[model samples]
Target: MADRLTGQPFTTRSEIIAQHGMAATSQPLATQVAIDILKQGGNAIDAAIAANALLGLVEPTGSGIGGDLFAIIWDAQSQQLFGLNGSGRSPISLPLNYFSQQKLTAIPAFGPLSVSTPGTVDAWYEMHQKFGSLSMATLFQPTIDYAEQGFPMTETISIEMALSAKHLQGFPNFAQTYMPNGMTPTKGTLFKNPHLANTLKHIAKYGRNGFYKGDIAKTISRYMKDNGGFLNEEDLSQHKSEWVTPISTHYRGFDVWELPPNGQGIAVLQILNMLEQHDISRMGFGSEALIHTVIETIKLVYEDRAKFYCDPDFNHIPIKTLLSKDYAQKRNALIHYKANLQVGSGMSGSHHIGQNLSALNHGDTVYLTTADKQGNMVSLIQSNYRGMGSGMTPTNLGFVLQNRGQLFSLHPQDHNVYQPNKRPFNTIIPAFVTQNDKPWLSFGVMGGPVQPQMQVQILMNLIDFKMNLQEAGDAPRFLHAGTSQPTGKKMTQGGYISLESGFSASVMQGLIDRGHDIQDLSGEFGGYQAIAWNDKKQVYFGASESRKDGQASGY
Candidate 1:
């Protein structure tokens, strides 16, 4: 009954191929919205921004204007990749001493205390200012109309919405905005937020000032003051997205790229650098050797991540040393046929590393990639952090403030420790790949720590196993969670493994024999989206994860 010729068993469909333009995103509506923008003569970056705005309205569980954004853009004209870090900082008024006086060991996951200045709007403005050809009004109008006219909630978003309502409903203005009539929305339910429509109108008209300096900024500041939150108008106004050079590591023949510190993107490069030593193709996909090697490699790099990964502006990160081939070789030497019970970071740290690994694995985020006929491609990831954010919904603003500050450590000496005007350690990242100095792939996986792990697997599937774009994403993914986190928690007892459903029983037994703690976990593998350039065919191949309510379409 199914066409099995071009697809793996797990692949729900073949990759979408198009010569003109392509877009892949977590929601079908959002994907279509991007295609619409491209059809309207917008570039890949413009379509990405428009689709992201629509996602904030349609899939608030994973993304919103309240979140932070990171992107890797492949500019066909320059033949160079660009990275944008649009993350925000903590309020200058709240110093580390405040947390000390409060005697809080970690920032709370939800509430005004965890709130940070939102950077999504500024990110949109920055991106549009640099590369956009269309007016802000043109890019945002579709989402504004959708927000007012309403869109049907997909099943995935519906489930997440119900879960979010349980924790967020009690917060100020959350119920009035999300849970209308005091009820959680179900699948196929049409939802509208006229307030969000108004907000989008302001953004479309006034660009960045509409959000960070005007009535919107005042409302946010007033809301924080009343709710005991630290974020204020000044914090919002001072927020800016920085354009940074993307860092890369050569794996097998292709160059894999990710953003530097402040975000955990480079961890993908670090992990790939370690795995480069192994001849994984011979081991085969889903084999004991390959899975074990990948899992172990992930553990090795994540150790370095916890100790070294942070905002480079605040602390000097040993990027050159960590990504050095010599360093990877030394780390790879520590891996063997059996799981290493005692794993430590490559670097020495004052705080204990890998001592008490946190079991928290899930994160709420959305990833999308778009390719234009001009050969430009954009890989973008956005998140509200911990799902639906801090629950600090400003009145009539129609979006919650991000709780990203929760990732900051209370340890004063830690690189990611809470500080005035410093950004919290961000988990969201965007990734890209190039071959022979040409844009090869624009892709990303969205989950907490799962982002880097899944990203590494995707590259391996493509380069090592030669799987097609769709098959590469649909392949069974293993999540090796509980590595030391930026929040100052360490992994203990070698951490554990959560295998996806597609792995064989023998492979499961193989991991168990190797001293791995194989356990069943609710699927947290991650949602993926990608667009690859076919230099020969002169077309684009797009793929979206089957596990998500997403679509990959082309014109």
Candidate 2:
């Protein structure tokens, strides 16, 4: 039996990681590396970057050099929250005319055509340049070592790799990199990628130039040409991570912040605002009424998401109109608890906007949270879009290019229609919560649309149900997915609700009686990681998901 550390009856899966610093990530080694960085006097930014880089190497099924990134960092000194939109843009060379010419109604989810210019390396360097204490080379050393010498394959990674093989085996270099022995490695097998190590080493030595330019860029260019993909060196060289202000909505006095679109963080705010309209606490956790309210809110907000959320650089999104309390008040009236759920975007004199239930991709991202002694906290999420990405592996890169372009709509009138150099609609988001202008929590969940769904439930658990960070994370969750699927499928009426175990039979029956489409989902809720600060005590608490091979630790 383990000796309990805290005297206050150390309860729940969350640990009191306080005093100095703490780090929680989807990989145990990455978590340790982050804590080690904190101990070495690196700040939260450096610790987060260190862990995230390792995730790219170890959890390549989820994230990698070929994917995109998003982060919300709480600057303890400035008392200001910052957001980074690290998502990549579509190929400048790929025009809307091409899709129209091909008569394709949807962006292909796999193959070279789906590839976007990867932005993760730029994100790592940008944050580090702004806030890191450790040198770039030093921050990436742990991942480099793991990649070259190999780290033991986790059961989750092995499962994902095997699942991906059938879909990705024929893609170039994928077999050479991930299936070197003509098969996915079994759990605990020592998996090494010297090629990935070399790629990482190049960037560490040369900084951003190493990735966005030079040999790395050329290799990606060649791969694109050979595969008929349109992303070119210009797209790679022109890429820059944007520093944006975080958007927030007050929920029960706590301010929940998310990055502005093209990522779906705003959806997190919208759902929260709708829930705040009613006394969620009065309904209680897992109650049919609460579940129904949550589901109906999601259905409405996601209808708005599909209609208007897009790359702001290309489309003028009415952020002020979308986040307004008046808008939420109007939307909240549509939630008839007793009626069958048939939802759509409410008319806003607002952006005149108009909205699937396809398979929601899961388990393709690594979410991490880190805090430093200085009070800086980071909530970061990185992903390859879907497990193993587009199956378009550049030779010797040891990572698959992201298929983010798949989120684009083929409809010309759609705000999210694919265009040259535009970012597609993004799902990966990192979140922060502040109370009384002080950093309260930094957290995120992994899984496509499930990211926002999990965010709402996690915040509600903490705020409404008074659950600790660990308990909030460990609690069974429900996913109401009626949003347009990335596969271009139509959103279903009364979108199916996937409930995890623990709800009472009566609650399930109650939902059914209310005309809810109920189903059981085994493990697709999300993998959560979060860090909460006890401002009075000057300490932090960290929690890692029970569903993932992850850890939360501090010194």
Candidate 3:
């Protein structure tokens, strides 16, 4: 019997596996844009920008110009690593007293009050200014064309839009802009956003100011002010993305690097550190032992993240102490060979040390990985907190604003307290692994609070289990959702671990035996994309998540 969905003949694995220059992503058009840029002799940065711009057009609900950006770039020539902190700060008008006066317990859900100044466009410009050969205008042309002329609605985009449509219906501008005719466009239907096209055009012509200080900013601020929102002209004018040095640790013979603070990259490094002592290969891939070790390591790292990780500017993140070999050894010592340890019981060393760590808020983000012909590589991640970002589409800008402000803790005593002009805690971490001094792979995953867990699994698959980039990304995964205490009493239900379909039944039973409440997921836990540099082949190979409706293509 024929498969009713895909009418055409399905290609065999032998044929599909023979394809070259792989590029994996969450959307088809974004992958094509990267392939086009690579074909045109552009490097990784250029290709990444091209792809990222197109993602804003096609996958508007996930990411766009109105968001923060972060990246870990590996320069092959100088053998130096660079980090871009494209996160935006809170509005100066957002005083702590404002929330107090309004008697608000937490930040608003989706509105102007929840919005933050977007830093993605300027971040792209800054990255191009420092490393790209192609003009910024050229990088944006593909995206502008897609936005103005229209592009086909993809299965992933359509589904995500429809599922989240309820949150989007309240904002008339967003509805009119994205759903125009009072209906979500079906897959393969042509979708265009003229307002976004004009916005991109202004950026191409006038540079980054096209959105920050000019007409676009004015329109956004005006809309927010009139709508009982906190974002103002001052927020737009004050927004600036920074460049920071990346934090790294050596595992086996490879060096893994990730951005500091704001991002949860340090947590990923910590997980690797905890698992470093175990010969996971000896446990055999996907064995109960291997899964247990991996899950235990994730719990240790995430426990620290919940306790201590936040914006470094606002809180003292002991990055060096956390990633140090001594800390890893101490945490690794808690792993028992026979069974899974309870969450609170897993804490080693002084209990006072654990008190310093506090749980922070998470945000929605996108991740992109690229490797150019010249060996330059980029692991990029960006976000607007959630789908359609606060659900506020200011009159002519054509982009939804990010709700980063919601990441702030409403409590004044909290380390991540909502403060004027302070950045929020973000989960958008990108990672790179290097052999010797050369970049070996660029990878990242998109999930609100699942990033650290997903990253650790990918690293384990590649570093510990010896799998390739595609296999590592395609492998089944699990996440131990961290817990939050409202009144110093730990909430155990939040500690429930989620497992994907491919995990072994033995592993599931083992987790259950250890007192973990287990939940099953239908393989859509997280979306991951990765690129590996093959020194022998002298070409880049990319892999996109099979669970997602996107592909990876390279030229």
Candidate 4:
């Protein structure tokens, strides 16, 4: 297959092309903000930070300062990629004994117990210190202005706000900040948060200290203490983003890189490794054979994910062994024409694979990609777990604390079991593709487990099927939900598969005939945004998800 000259039925629009720079984000305003930063003499890193700050203000339903951040950057100067793990840890003061003492089987989805130390602000500062061209104040000014002056809520965000308001209104400051006048903002409503502006101003002037060591930290600690939470000033102050070496797997001569454990990114690499065994292109896109192989591969990889993916500091992960081609081949051999509902971890031994599980769906998140004239590109993702997060808004903070800690398993023997000061198993990850040691693409799909599944599909679409950047993102995707997660959930029913509306009835029937359970679940497929570098053309290509209020623009 080759790149199509005519439009494919799935493509929403042609790829945005430009020589100087390009950006793709979930929100149009954020994309414009990135472009503006690039035009203002800022590098890709600076532009990404600026756009993320603005997103925190305008798209708080998904991302905010209260969430965690992860990024993969293609540094033009070094000609190498960098990975940043900006995820936060559970409070050291919160002991596992407390949960056991309370007789709680699982952490509550919302409220104080789920909140963790926020790491987004520190991650921004760290990325800036290493690669930023503009001052922190300059990068933050646009968001601060928008926060105080107000910005129009997008259609999707407004509906999400109303939903969040219903669940989080009881939390301190949530109603005041998001539900002004006792109601959530509707589409086109000009929402303003002067308090968030003040907070951003503090960060602009004092850097990470503004949030981790100063008034913001103190306020968060006080609120948690009074509200039956365990996070404190110490947890905030001790937080630091780690600069990690990105790991990769070669697929069809392309090096696909993702961060190590504590995030589910490697699941993409695992799926791809297993997929490399089959000539999927021959099976054809959306064919029953292709879908079945991918789905079965996912189930096998997720079993390993549930058992091994965790905070590296707490347990040693066999990163090398797990990503081995031999292991992938062994796993791939298990796939057949039919679905396999009864799967177990490939490696022996047992931790409590979760007895009860909640399908992580519609995880509110933001993913954006940017490339500048200097040839630098950034793939960044940020999120407040679930919807608007833990619903434990600190008084006057104007943001919700992330419920990421809810991902930690209560099972004592699990590697991802709840532990004080340990980072939870993260769902958000940034991805990159390099061809022959040069940056080729910076992209990400935003949702929980939907991420790795989409990542593999995107890669296959581009490499195996030869789709253009936009077409790859816009193509019909299959979401494999209910797989065992790091939360120790077991897959007793083999889980189910959800396909986008674009799939043909023949494909659906084929999958069902193969013993695969197919469901019509829309809006849970995850949002995608990507930027691909065309070295020969000396230009960039960008694509944004049509399912979202997204934009892919260049200049």
Question: Candidate 1 residues 422-538, lDDT tens each?
Answer: 988899999999999998999998887678999989999999989899999998899886678878887867888999887889999989999999877665888899999999989
Clash count list over all predictions: 3, 2, 9, 1
Model 2 residue 148 lDDT score: 86
Stretch of 10 with least lDDT, candidate 2 = 1-10
Model 2 clashing residue pairs (backbone):
356-490, 356-491
Of candidate 1, the 10-residue stretch with the lowest lDDT total is 351-360
TM-score comparison, 1 vs 3, better candidate = 1
The TM-score of predicted model 3 comes to 0.90
lDDT of every predicted structure (CA atoms): 0.88, 0.85, 0.74, 0.90
Per-residue lDDT of model 3, residues 1-555, tens digit only: 342232212211110121234455678878788877877778878888888888887887678888888988988788888999999888887788887798976777577777878889889988998899888778889988888889889886787777656786787488888886887788999999888888888888988888788888898889888877778778887877899998889888889888888767888888888778888778866667777777777766766765566677777767878989998998888777544445542333322211111222233456787776667888888778776688888997778888877766676555566788888777788888888777788889887667877887888777777766667777677776544321112334325677776666887887777666776444336788888877766777677777666677666
Candidate 4: where are CA atoms >4 Å away?
1-5
How far off is residue 335 in model 4, in Å? 0.9
Write candidate 4's Cα lDDT for 255-323 as tens digits.
999999899999999999999999999999988889999999999999999999999999999999899
Task: Assess the local accuracy of residue 188 in candidate 2 as a C-alpha lDDT between 0 and 100.
Answer: 91
